[model samples]
Target chain A: MEVLFTFLPKTAHQEKLEKEFPDVDFHFTYKEKSRLPSVDILVTYGEDITEEDISKAEKLKWIMVASAGVEKMPLQAMKERGIAVSNVKGIHKTPMAESVLAHLLALKRSLPFIYESQQNNQWNRKTGSSELFGSTALILGPGAIGSEIGRLLQAFGVRTIGCNRSGSAADYMDEMTSFEDILMKLPEADLIISVVPSTKETKHMLKKEHFEAMKKDAIFMNFGRGDLVEDQILLEALENGAVGYAVLDVFEQEPLPPEHPYWSMKNVVISPHASSHSKKYVDRALDIFIPNLHKWLSEDLNPTNLVNLEKGY
Target chain B: MEVLFTFLPKTAHQEKLEKEFPDVDFHFTYKEKSRLPSVDILVTYGEDITEEDISKAEKLKWIMVASAGVEKMPLQAMKERGIAVSNVKGIHKTPMAESVLAHLLALKRSLPFIYESQQNNQWNRKTGSSELFGSTALILGPGAIGSEIGRLLQAFGVRTIGCNRSGSAADYMDEMTSFEDILMKLPEADLIISVVPSTKETKHMLKKEHFEAMKKDAIFMNFGRGDLVEDQILLEALENGAVGYAVLDVFEQEPLPPEHPYWSMKNVVISPHASSHSKKYVDRALDIFIPNLHKWLSEDLNPTNLVNLEKGY
Candidate 1:
């Protein structure tokens, strides 16, 4: 079987794969190529792959996304070809969930204001710093990462509500809701975390209407794809007191422009999409890949984290 | 039964107590006076009461500490008098543990820097942020809050070790060690959170010797009493590259003197002693109090959270 690996040009992961699976022929290429035949599996990272490249992989029986989301992949073509798709879903869960909690705790405990005061060498002992206990957390996606977040939140005694495609109760979630029911539960949440993968249905999911439905002092966090929310609407919400504060780890564009209005917003915390890029990420990713590779070599029909081509998760 | 409520200027809590138990005669007095007659129970906050005061109350069978710790209570007198001393030990567990994770996460994710940069409208992005997954965490105390912190860290896939009085393995701790064994484990920790109360043994526990054993860039946090660590040693450690960064929520003397060097240190994040003070505290404290009070009144030896007068936790 011929396997094609597509990613940003920087890694020895392909070399490691070649050593482990010497019998299987492997080709390494960038995501921009127009055609690639005899490829049984194509692995790509981030949102760099084009639909044209995906269409040309005529013999591609499976698509292995190196990222957690398949939103950027040619889902329609993969579905038409009856190709199986799997994603590296749990790889980013640890760092992303930890970052979400970091921002939530920062906002709740007034870390920003405290740090700012510290820079001025001020020992201002401000009162009314809130705690996470008894706070309501509404996680927008209850996948492996979201469930892990819920477990962490449960340890702090926070009430967790999950929103997913099926609206089924997860182990750590106290309540479950569908996407349409989110507005009804928004006002009750003190913290709203967006972890849903980018999809046609999820794009602009958290718009002006959703923001308006949230509580006045609610904290908003986005560790998922940026396009899932409308940035301009979020800015307006932050300005008008519809949303108290926002911690954005992902953006519509990488390295958010310095002149962007979000840079100047005091209520907004903008990170350069580095939340999930941790020192241990490569090792952690390999941990998941090694076992799955073994399973694939044995002709396993179902991959561990099979992605629904139609759903784009 | 005569009950003495100690502390100056009692407010709504005392009034509520008065209304709830009208049949039991209660004497509310300031900490200065020692004229209270023999009482069956003594309820007190953070005020020093002499052995003479406990001696006067010949009928005092139980002491209920309004505060979390009984370090200031006349434990010797109570022990001699054969009076049971109970404290609000687990009440602060959720909030304090949350604070520990909060600051640790904040430090690891560069929240202080991100927050400050956001204020200046700067879009600075740094790489190689650390993740909690596969990281080792050494919790200095395995009390209620430390154990709760262990549970929180478990969800993030961190290996949690704890130090305790008996060196017995706690439910959430991967390994439990005595004070003498702490140095051996320090080199392995990526994060060290101190949640130990200020006992004679714990005071200045995280001093120069202990800090010297930690990893080069390890993150340190203290949600425990400030006396558990020496501020001067911590400052020196940070300066000499022994400790990378610290997040302190408690201080030796708060409001930490405005001229303190920590206020000017860039790598430190200091907060007032407000980590355990939350909106839900009063209700949660009452939840424990009401149930325990009923048991005490019924003479059922309601030893739900009996404090060890010797250990002083």
Candidate 2:
């Protein structure tokens, strides 16, 4: 069985993958390259691959995406070709969840102001700082990353509520609600974390109306996708005090424009899209892929983290 | 039956106490003033309570301190008078632990640079960021706050080691060791968190030699008293790359001088000792203290969180 490694910035991560899978016959190529007829498994990074890449690999049975979001991939083509798609879902959970908690704690503890004071060597003890314990956290996505965040928040004794497509119960979550029902529960959340994948149903999910439902001092954290939230509406929410602070790690544009107003906003924390980019990220991705590769080859078993091309999970 | 509030800034907290303990006779006064003869319990805030105040309170059997640190109080004087002392220990755990995690995540994920770029409205993608999972964390104090931090770290799958006087086993802590043994283990820690109380033995515990033992790119966090670490030694470590970065919330002196090098160091994240100063802190402290007070009065039970006068815990 042949395995094809198709990813962008392939040269950067190729050495690491070569070292881990010395025994496997791996073909390292750009996502745009013509696929060989014998290719059975394809691994991709980013959105460099096209529909033609999927159609050419006649024997391709599996396509693994090295990212949490699979929205940009040619999902319909893969599904029609009987190619199973799996994603690097839970791998981003720790770093993403850590980022969410970092902003939440920073906002409540006022670390930015404290850091500024330290910059000026001032020992001003500003009042009105708050703790996370006994506060409510509303997680918009109850997937691997969102659930992991809830578990972390549980240790701090915060009430956790989750909003998902189905509105089903999640471990460590106090309550679950559907996407349409999020407005009803918005006032209960002191902090709202958006980790939902980008899709038709979720695109622009956090619009002006959702912000209107939030509490006065509510903090909004987005580590999922930039397109999932309407930035203009979010800014309006911040301006009106409907949103206390917005901690963003992803934006619609890769290099946010210099003239953007978010740069000067004190209430917003704009982080480059690097929340899930960690040192061990590649190793972690390999940790999952290698085992699944062996399982697919030997037992013809489907991977556990298979992503539905139609549903866009 | 009678309670005396003996703190200079007791008026604000005293009002809440009065409402909670309406049945008990409450007398509010500064520590320099004579305590009411009928007082059985004395509550104080600051370090320096006059000797005259202690001698005058002949009926005082129990003393409660509002702060976490009991170092400034005359422990020997209270011990000689057979007075029981209890403090609001672990009340600072939520905010402090959250702060430590905030800085650790920020340093690992490079939040400072991201925030700066956000200020410039530049959305740059940075590589080489590290994750907390599979990392090793060494907590100096394995008391309530430290153990609470341990629970938070467990969800991230980090290896947690602790150093305390007793070296007792704690949940979520992989191993416990004495302060003297910390040097030998420092090399293994990716993150070193100082949560130890400021005491004679612990003062300046993280000196030049200790910093030299840490691994390269290792992160240092000080949510404990600033006196526990030697400032000059820490600066040298940061400069020499022995300690990659530091997230300090407390300092030896309040309002660190503007000329201090810490303010300008890119490797350091200086916070003005506001980690535990959250808005809900008072309510949380009261929640713990009120229940303990009820136990003390109704059940004829001594508070479980009693402090050891000699140990200064």
Candidate 3:
């Protein structure tokens, strides 16, 4: 069997894989296009997978993404090829939540203002600093990542209201509500965080009506798919003071076009979609890969966390 | 009863107090010096309390300082006059802990670098990012504030070692050790946070030797007393790569001076001695004040969190 791994290979990991499947020809390079026809498995973190590679790979039975989202993959081609797919989802639960908190605390504590003061060699105590202690947070898409975020916030004494498709209670949330009721529940939260994924139904789910329904001083944060929010509506909300602050980790476009208004906005906090980027990412990714690899080898057990292509999740 | 308050009066709180103690004369201004002579009780957050004022308040039986530190107060006079002195010590636990987490997450996720990129209107994804998960944190002074910080860090899957005088295990710490063992244990930590107070033994507790003992890539944060750390030694560590990053909220000299190298250092993050700051400070202050007021009115038990003039804690 020929296995093609797209990420940089670690010595220990390569040795471990070789020891497990002694007869397998393991190739760890993205540029090995000539070997595509004989490749039995394709492992990727979304840099080199393309429709052409998928078409050329006649023996490819499995394609694994080492990140949560498989949106970067040529899903249509893989789906038609009857290729099994799985993504590393649960690993990013804590790191992304931690990243959300990093910005939320900075915004509340005015750490950026403090940084500006430090640049001028001044020691200034920024007044009117807020606390998460008594504030209420509305968490959209209360799945793994969102629930983890709520759990962390719960430690800070913030009341978390989980919003999902079903109005079912989650472990860390103080209460639960349906996503359909988001606008009605909007004004109640002092902090709003959305972790909704990108889908046909979820794209552009939160916009002008929802932002306008929020409290004037409410903080809006999106660590979810950028498509879940409308960029123009968010910009208008910030300018109109409907949203007190917006901490955006993902954008409708990557690199944010260099001249976007969000880059220079006073009330905006921007990060280059690196929230889930952790040194431990590869190790955690391996945890998913090893398990699913065994399942694929057995050929009888269905792979866990396999992406449902028709549902487009 | 005559009560002299040195803080500006909030109308709602004043009304609530007056409604309960109708016969008591409450003078809520520092400039009301004529009433100082007859002040039976003094409430201050440290602007109006002076040795001369203490001498004039012959009838002052109780003096409540609405802050954590009593180093600025005339302890000798208060102890000599047989007046009860209390300072709000435990209220800053959550806010300071929050502040510590803010910087800890920021450092681990490269928030300072993100801010610089944002300043240039750039969207560069910083690689080789770190996480608090599976990291070891050594917390100095595991009392009210330090323990709270440990609890929050524990939620992020960090192994926290608590340091105290007795070396007894604290609630949130995975292990406990004495302050004497800090040097030996220093090399084990990826993160070191100090919440130790300004005391005779604690003054200049951390210096060049301690920073040199730490892991080369370790992050050093101080939300403790400025005197506990030697700033010159800290600067040397940062300059020589002995310390990977230094987030200092307090300094030996603050408004941290215009000429200090820390203000210009690339590896430094500074906040102006405002770790304990929060918009709910007054409400938390009232939590201490109201309790002490009732205790005084009852005239039975001594006020809680009293400052020991002799031991100076």
The number of the candidate with the highest DockQ is: 3
For A47-141, candidate 2 gives per-residue lDDT tens digits of 87678777777888888888878877888888888888888889898888777777776667676776667666676778357778788999988
User: Could you arrange the candidates by DockQ from highest to lowest?
Assistant: 3, 2, 1
Interface RMSD of each: 1.9, 2.0, 1.3
- What are the RMSDs of all candidates, in order? 4.5, 3.6, 1.9
Top lDDT model: 3
Question: What TM-score would every model get versus the actual structure?
Answer: 0.82, 0.88, 0.96
Assess the local accuracy of residue B60 in candidate 2 as a C-alpha lDDT between 0 and 100.
82
| Top candidate when judged by TM-score against the true structure | 3
TM-score of chain A of each: 0.87, 0.89, 0.94
Q: Is the docking of candidate 2 incorrect, acceptable, medium or high quality?
A: medium
TM-score of 1: 0.82
Q: What is the C-alpha lDDT of each candidate?
A: 0.78, 0.79, 0.85
- Model 3 chain A: weakest 10-residue lDDT segment is A295-304
Residue-level error in angstroms, candidate 2, position A201:
1.7
lDDT of 1 by residue, A188-262 (tens): 999898888788788887778899999998998888889988778888899999989888888887678878988
lDDT of 3 by residue, A124-184 (tens): 7864567778889999988899999999999989999999888888879999999788888
